[model samples]
Target: MTLTESSQSLDELLKPRRLFRRLIAVIADLRLAIILLLSIALFSISGTVIEQGESVAFYQQNYPEDPALFGFLSWKWILILGLNHVYSTWWFLSLLVLFGSSLIACTFTRQLPALKVAQRWKFYQEPRQFQKLSLSTELKTESSSSLIAQLEKKGYKIYQENQAIYARKGIIGKIGPIVVHVAIIVILAGSIWGALSGFLAQEMVPSGATFGIKNIIEKGLVAASPLTKNWLVKVNRFWIDYTPDGKVDQFYSDLSVVDKEGAELDHKIIHVNKPLRYDGVTFYQTDWGIAGVAVQINNSPVFLLPMAQLSSKGSSRIWGTWIPTKPDLSEGVSLLAKDLQGTMLVYDKEGNLTSAVRPGIPLEINGVTLKVKDLIGSTGLQIKSDPGIPFVYTGFALLMLGVMMSYVSHSQIWILQANECLYIGGKTNRAQVSFEREFLQIIEEINEAQTPTLSVANEIKN
Candidate 1:
């Protein structure tokens, strides 16, 4: 081959090698990993601070154009940046992918090699090798078997070659970082999978209502499959308990999961913090409101009037409904209720206070006697389908395990027997003082055992 042609081919080969090295350096860089972690944290915090999956009207109302929040953030920016749903954003997913790639690179380039180095046993063949250790000692001994026993008693894996001996403990310390990286990768994979295939929906159903999964607030890109539409939910009943002092104690809803063939699959009494899970979907009771009230007017048939919840903005909850007293639907009394305590405030058409009446109590308004009947309650439920929850939980468990394993100190001891003299040395990745103390204790035992043997040899020589 011509010299110039061969040089060109070599250069072409070197180009890919150099590029590969550069890529590895960038992915394995600790600083890059830290920066990516911090960026992920910052975006996660933003996701928490700013509400997710709200309507455009909600954002427009909260973040107006005239005066934006923090002097910069507005509804337009939120929509454009996909801050309305941060976790499912393409950029966030890409960040997770890059961080995972960094972890893989670091694991392969740093952690595994370190573990292999730790697991390899290298016996000290020469006396001078003892000088290289952080802790070294010299003693007169004919055999290293007793010293090896002492090391083994201290929880070390022993390796012997002729007159040389090598021992180590806590090999898991070297493997811990790799396990941690794997756990983090698993968690990231779970999060990414959830973001891709999970969905969130909300439902406000009155008692005795059967409904399908509708009103999706947020859903993943690939979550609109037929599996989400296969099941049905039924809110059998909803009620609230009141304390003796007229405060709400707890609210509950009886719910059932139904199949496509109208068969009940499961049933549960759902409350706040106590959710029901079935078919990878969880139903949580998030809120409750008054649906309607039944009332009898002047011995007439009982009629149900739907109650509308009034905007309290941060105040107490209140639901109101207008009851027509005249045939023209002009003259009516407004009923306002604050709780399920069976008490309501009645107001005349002129907005004047008429009277307060409880359930089963009679009140005279506009010369007509009204008897309050039962009040129906509605349950606010949040439904979510996340297939990655198990993997995420497992990853966290492994993370804790890795953290514990990392705390163990990997220690190594080498003993070389040269003629009648023994060279002993040791080192540890952590807990230097403790290892030193243990090394000293082993040396003392070796000296005590050898003293009797030396005395017997001296007696024989005499």
Candidate 2:
């Protein structure tokens, strides 16, 4: 073969081999584990620092360009790679999956064996081996059978074939690590599953407004009920009562939930803390907003505002215009009113006037000044739907139960036999100090019981 062709073939063969090796190295590296942990921390901080799911322009406007550093965390690649939304990032998810698998693998390869070793009970009569233990007691006595019988009476199965006694307590003590590791696996799996499959939205449906499915924050991926295609909800009336300190003590909404095509599915009165659930979708009284408002002029009269006006022929058209106080004035205002700033304008039938008004301030028009008498505030609600939430909650409950059980473990001791000399030992799966105290008490009791009473004849002779 020609040298050029041979070199190319060698390069092709080596390239894939190098790539394969690199991939394996990356997967096995401890740094990857550290990276996963750090990423979790980073995401947690990010969630707290920056408002998530904001518009792209918001980040740009807020964080201006800097010559030294990249544009204030602005990277086209970030959006494309889903770094802007780290919760949905494939790499982050992959890290979680890897960590979960590692936990499972570690459980099987390391923890399981350790647990088995801990669970297994072996009769070790060697004093040297017993001396190495964290807690041990050596009792030397002339009669081995009596000592073995004493241990048996104490609820310990003692092996006494050799000169020394062998007994073990709390055989299940070895299984602690296994249970903990497996529980960790279950918890992590539940968390990941919930993150991927759960749907949560906080939509403020205004009173008397029907909401379409897409109007909610979590829209696209939500499934429809088999019986009803779309879950329709209408907020009939929303009431919020706050404490004297302005803290929201309670809130509720009178609502009617319907199926697609306007069929009443259910009626519910949901509150801030109480939610209505049906067909795997939970309807929460999270919030309410201004669908439309009755426009009042100087608090004198109210006018129903139309969203849009349509022509009589059924063609849609919107008609509305802001009327200044002085319609005849030439110019007295800038057209913009946003960001808490109200535009000031001067206008006279054939002349110009100058005046400025903030949103909360009043403006004089014609001859009288009009004030913004009231404002209708919108409500904020949080909604969540997850088929996996139950699993997640169950796992958390189990985790808490296991921790409490391990922390508050109950230990017991039984005295097999007590003769002139006896064997004493107790087993505890948790709180070794407490177990030791209990065992000491038992030993003390046995010693007291074995104490010989001075006979009356011997006492009188003395």
Candidate 3:
């Protein structure tokens, strides 16, 4: 081959190596990692501050454009930027993958190499090498075996050569940062997985009713349909416990999981903060409502009147139903109940207050005897399923272990006996004061080992 052709071929071969090196350098940059972390934090804060998975009318009403929220956030911008569902957005997930790549690059390029170097056995062969340590001292001594025994007593892993000894401890600390980075990456990946494979659903089922999951407000892009369950859920009964003042203290629902033939598979009574898990899906009791009121008009068979929720300010809820007082349907009375405590306010068609009534009570309203037999209650449940919870939990466990391991201080000591002078020094990556005190105590013990019996042994050997 001609010299010019050989040079061109060599240049072509080096281009790929140069590109790979540059890529590694960029991904392992500390500044890039910091920027990515800060960006993730800021976007996470945004996701928390903004409510997610609401209808368009809700956002338009709450975050109007003319007077936008915080002077910049509007319904238009929220939908445009997908801030409503920030965690599941493509850009946010891309940032996470990029940050994870950076962590992996740094672990391979810097942290692993450092740990390998720390594990390597390097004997300080020359006295000058001991001088390079942060703490060093020269003692007029000859016996290196006594120093080796003292170091072994102090929990150091020892390696001995002809005249030099090397001891190290806390090598696990060097591996801690790498584990921490891996744990964070795992957590991020799990979060992304959950955002793509989980679902959230809400249901308002009346007492003594069987239903399938259908009302899904928010779900992952690739989540399985919750309706694929082989079993059905039945709300056997719903009730509330009232305080002494007739206020709602707690609510509960009796639920049953039934198969296609209506045979019960499992049953449980669930309340707030206590949920039921079945086949990876969790059901939580979130709300309670009045489904309907059963009433009987004079000599007429009892019939159920469906109650509708009335909009009110604040957190209080009220449901109302209207019953015809006459067969002609010309006059009627409205029954309004705030809770399942069996008390209701009765109003006439003319908007005049009639009387207060309770269940199993016969009341005379609008010249007709109206009897309220019972109030049917309904249970509202929130359902959720996530396949990534185990991964997240595992990541958190590893993170705690890594944090504890990182606290351990890695210390190394090197000693050499040359020309009747014992040169010794040590250093620590952390807790320098403690290491210094330990090093001094070891030196003091070595000084004490030079006894008269040892000198007689030396004379006997001569």
Candidate 4:
């Protein structure tokens, strides 16, 4: 057989059950766990190292000299293995899936047996067995039957007799690990789902501006929606508070949501950390501001005007319509025609007329150059949405609860008398030492009940 065929045969020999065992062993082995963890860490570093979601041309322009190396590291290989985004990497996700599967298998294999043992209330008790118990005690009485009767009266069910006795308490204490293991799977699944499908992003809603999901990043299979149809979100107003040093202290945006059908749902004011949620979309107060540029041109204060100037302001500004004004009549320049470029007029009143002067360009007229003086540059805001956040959060909550329940177990005991010997025992799924102490206390209480006369005698003698 070929080497490939041999390898496949070997793999076939280690199918499902053996593979599961191997995964379990790896997960259980601290070394393998650490190795997998380090692998994940190293892969995650790649995501942070390389810029994500850039075009092919961008990488080519940036790394022209190292095309092969760049291709090997970039989206080329990332797309094949999903490593470009490490968190969503198929192998990484499979590792998590396999880890959970291993946990389930381990729970079934080892923990289930332990649980069965713990659930059994019938413990084989011989004199030798009771003698070797951590909490064994010896009691001598004239009548063993009377002692056993007393123990029965105290509520302990007696099983077997003669030289020793056996009893059990609280047999349900073995489910803690099972619960914890299940919870871990739940939490892991929830986190993975959140990473894959849950979207988190922001959008800036300027006052009176209506926008849609176009501002949100589309990942997985989320369809690209127009900036208007996803959701008609409007910012009614926005405000910010700042410190004396101009550091921002707090900010808020008053927002309203309009559905695709143009129906208003709810209006709310959102602040930092205090977000406004609507129809699975959550609006957070990321930032706010206004932006515009101040413009100036020529020696005169520039203002927008139509092709024809209708009136003159401040003696320098002129506005008019229908009648074409001759620049030469007013300023020793002859007017030829006027278009969008500006008035076409000649220097020296009637000599060769020059070309039209534009608004922002410099024109040489009698040794004077008219230049555009200034143009000033405004505010930026950041925004986001995650429709599946609630599901993710719910999953997280369940995971925590399951973990706690699986780790903490409830166990208690009831003391009773069967034939006159005190029977004491307790059970718990956690903190066996604590339960043991409680059992010891119960034994002491039984002794006190049986020895009250002796205690009274001692007290009287004292």
Clashes (backbone N, CA, C under 3 Å), per candidate, total 0, 15, 0, 38
Residue-level lDDT of model 2, residues 279-379, one tens digit each, is 66776665443333233335455444322222345442222223344436443332222111123233354544455444446666656555433223334
> In angstroms, how far off is 433's CA in candidate 2?
3.9
- Cα lDDT of model 4 by residue, 1-462, tens digit: 999999999889879878777766766664654565577567768778765544556655554545555455543554555544566556777766766666666677777988786555444233343444345554433234544455465455555444444544333335656766676667567656655654544454445556665544434334233342356777666666667755568776777887878677789877878877765556666544332111232354553322233243444332222211233434433322222123333335445646554435666654444432222111123333434455556656766665555655455332233344333344555677875775666566556655875679699999
User: lDDT for every model?
Assistant: 0.90, 0.53, 0.91, 0.52
Native-to-model Cα distance after best TM-score fit, residue 63 in candidate 3, in Å: 1.8
| Candidate 1 local lDDT, 24-47, one digit each (tens) | 989989999999999999999999
Each model's TM-score, in the order given? Answer: 0.94, 0.62, 0.94, 0.58
> In candidate 2, which residue ranges exceed 4 Å CA deviation?
1-35, 66-72, 75-83, 140-167, 170-173, 200-204, 216-228, 239-252, 261-263, 269-276, 282-289, 294-383, 408-432, 435-439, 453-462
- Give per-residue CA lDDT, model 3, range 1-462, as digits (tens): 999999999999999999999999999999999999999999999999888776788889889998998899999999999988888889999999999999999999999999999999888888888767999998887888888899899899999888888899999999999889989988988888888999888999999999999999878889999889899999999999989988889999999999988999889999999998888889999988899999999878999999999998978989998999988989899999998888899998887888999998899777778999999999999988888787889899999999999989999999888989999999999999999999999988888887775788899999
- Cα error, residue 26 of model 1, in Å, equals 0.3
Better of 1 and 2 by TM-score: 1
Give the candidates in order of lDDT, highest first.
3, 1, 2, 4
Give lDDT: candidate 3, residue 28: 90
Model 4: residue 381 alpha-carbon error in angstroms: 6.6
Write down the lDDT that model 2 would get. Answer: 0.53
**lDDT of model 3, residue 222:** 90
